[model samples]
Target: MALSHASLSLISMIFLAGSIVMLFFVILSGVTSTSPLSQTYFLRADTHGISGARAISQWTYFRICGDGNTDCSASYADPPVGYAWDGNPNNAPAELAGGHGGDTTSSSYFFMWRFGWVFYLIGLFFEVLTFGSGFLALCSRLGSAVSGLLSLISLVFLTVGVSLMTATFVKMRNAFVADGRDASVGTYAFGFSWGAWTALLISTILFCIGRHSNKADVPSSGRRWGRRSRSTRSHRSYEGRRVKEEYP
Candidate 1:
C-alpha cells in the first residue's frame, strides 16, 4: 500500500515537471499583461496605430502582430478591435480602452490569454493543496490506490499550472524581446528565475513522495480477508451460543 502511494506521488511530481517545462515555451506565444506594448504586441487592427491588447492568440495576418501601420493596422487588432479592455460597446464603460481589456483603467479582462498571471496563481494554489494533503500521508497507512488517484489528479493539475505559467512567461518574454529594455523593465513578471525552477522541483518532490508511499500499503489491500476473518469469528460465536442454549 505504501509503495503504491509513493508511486502515485512520484508519478504526479514527474508529470508536473514535464508540464512546467512545456508551459514555459507555450506561454511565450501570447502577450504578457504588463504595460501596453506602446503600439507593440498582438495582432492589431489596420485602421489606426493604437495598440490593442486584444487576442494575441492568432498568428495570422491581422491576427499575427502589427504596429498600427497600413500593412497590419498598426494595432493589435483585426477588422474588429479586440482590446484587453472594454472594446465591447454594449458593455463598454466610461473608462473603456484603458488597457488590459477591462471597463476600469485598473480592472483586468482575461480574454483568451490576457491575464496569464491569474491562471498561474490559481494553478499554484491547487498544486499546493494537493501537495499539502498528501505530502505526509504518503508514508502513512493511507491506501496506495488512493494516493495513486491523488497523484494522478495532482499531475493533471500540475500540467495546467505549468502551461499557464509558461504562457504568461512567454508573453512577457516576447514583450521584452519586441520592445527592448527601454520599453519594459528588464525582468518579466512571469520570469525564468531560480524561484520558478524551485517551485517545479518542490512539486516534483511531493509527487515522488506520494508515489513511493503507495508501494508500502499492502495491509490496506487485504481488507477483504480481514473482513472475512471477522465474519468467521462471529459465525463461530453464534454457533457456540446455539449449542449452549440447547444444553440448558
Candidate 2:
C-alpha cells in the first residue's frame, strides 16, 4: 500500500510538470508576438504601404496592429476577411475602391472581448494551488487528502476557464459574419489555448487518483480488526467470570 501510494504521488507530480510546461508554452507563444491563431496582412495605396495583424482568444484579445507610412494607402484585407477583425462600420480608404472592411479601432473594444481574461486568471490561480499541493505531497510534507482537494478545485476553475475561452472564439467568429466577412474553420483555429486546457485536465485527473490512493494507504483495516478482537476477548472474559460464580 505504501509503495502504491508513493507511485501515485510520483505520477501526479509528473502530470503537474507537463501541465506547467504547456502553460509556459502558451506564454511563450504570446511573448514571441507570433499568435498561435491570427492573421497578418500587407496593405498598399498608390505609393503608401502598411502591415497589419490580429490575434484573439476567448480569454484574451491581442489588439489589431497596423504600420504604414502613408495616410492614403489602401488596406487590402485577407481573402474573405475571416475572424479577428473589428465589425464596426468605417469609411473606405483611398487605396480600396469599395468601403473599408477592417476591424474597428481595437481601443474601442475592451482588453478582452468579454470576461475571458478574468476567468483565465482565476483558473491560473487554482492551477498554482494544485501545483503547490502536489509538490508538498510528493515531498511528504503534506497529506494526499489535502493535495487531492486542491487539485479538484483547480480542475473546476480550469474547466470554466477553458469553456469561456472557447465561447469567446465562437463569439468572435459570429461577429465576423455580422461584420460582413466570411468566417471559416481555417480562420478561427484552436491553438495553444487548447493545448493548455488539455494539460490542465490531465493534471486534475492525476491529482484525484493520488488523493484516493493516499486515503487507501492509511492502516484503517488493522485498527478495526484490533478493536474487534479486543471487544471479543473482553466479552469472553465476562462470560467466564459469570459461569464460575454461578457454578461455585
Maximum-TM-score candidate: 2
156-212, model 1: which lDDT tens digit per residue? Answer: 554554354345334533443454321221132224322444555555555545545
Q: Tens digit of lDDT per residue, candidate 2, span 168-209? A: 446545554554444332222244456667766666666556
State in Å the error of residue 240, model 1: 37
lDDT of 1 at 42: 28
| Cα lDDT, all candidates | 0.40, 0.47
Q: Candidate 1 at residue 136, lDDT?
A: 55
Per-model TM-score, in order, reads 0.34, 0.55
- Superposed on all Cα atoms, model 1 deviates from the true structure by an RMSD in Å of 12.6
Candidate 1 segments whose C-alpha is farther than 4 A from its true place: 1-100, 103-115, 135-148, 172-248
Positional deviation of residue 92's Cα in model 2 after best superposition, in angstroms = 8.5
Q: Which residue pairs in candidate 2 have backbone atoms (N, alpha carbon, C) closer than 3 angstroms, thus clashing?
A: 45-74, 86-103, 86-104, 92-100
lDDT value for model 1: 0.40
